[model samples]
Target: MVKKIEVEGYNALIECLKENNTGTVFVHFSGSLDENGVNWCPDCVKADPVIARNVDKAPEDSIFIHCHVGPKAYWKDQNNDFRQDPKFYLRCVPTLLRIGSPQRLQEDQCCSDDLVQMMLEETEENVTPRY
Candidate 1:
């Protein structure tokens, strides 16, 4: 079974990553939620179901981290930690990335079931080597 973790903010995400860095790790960065449990980003809202459905494509021991990147104002700031952090350097919400690898899907890409499954099932041998 895949291990799933939900974290809010950059600090929480960093802490979670420190503890669970090994194995097949996937990080999903999305917008923060309100009291109603609804995310501020429409794209994130749309991509959630697609990602959830494709989770089974990953290995059983894989780790899935769902990171909420705070409110719209926070995410729009140029100094947002998620964007500045070299490990992520996120350009948009609803980003699905394979840790320790170059594989990633952003924005509308995350809403595509086909792309999400492809990323989840991709292996190290399938990754294109970086020059």
Candidate 2:
């Protein structure tokens, strides 16, 4: 079964990562809504169910995180760490990444079931070191 954890901000998400560093982790970034309850990024909304459907392909011990990066006003800020943080450097909403691994699916790629499965099931040999 896939364990899903929802986080609302960058610091909270980072803290969760630090505590769960050993096992497999799938991280996704998406834009959140304001008091009006409207999602800013349509892509993120579209990717949600696909991510839910494919998350079970991950290892048994793996964890999945759905991170809400805040409203459009926050994400649109050029100085946002969501775009500047090297660990993430997220260029788009609905970006999915395998923690401690190089596998990542961006933009429309995140909707591909095959690619998401491959990212979740990537073996040690298949993971190319980032640096």
Number of the top candidate by lDDT?
Answer: 1
Count of steric clashes across candidates, in order: 0, 0
TM-score for each of the candidates:
0.94, 0.91
List ranges where model 2 is wrong by over 4 Å: none
lDDT of 2 at 24: 74
TM-score between candidate 1 and the true structure: 0.94
Q: Per-residue alpha-carbon lDDT of model 1 for 1-98, expressed as tens digits?
A: 99999999999999999999888899999999988989999999999989988988988899999999999999999899999987787999999998
Q: Model 2: per-residue lDDT, tens digit, 41-122?
A: 9997788778778888888888899899987988889888788888887888889998766678887988888888888888
- Name the TM-score of candidate 2: 0.91
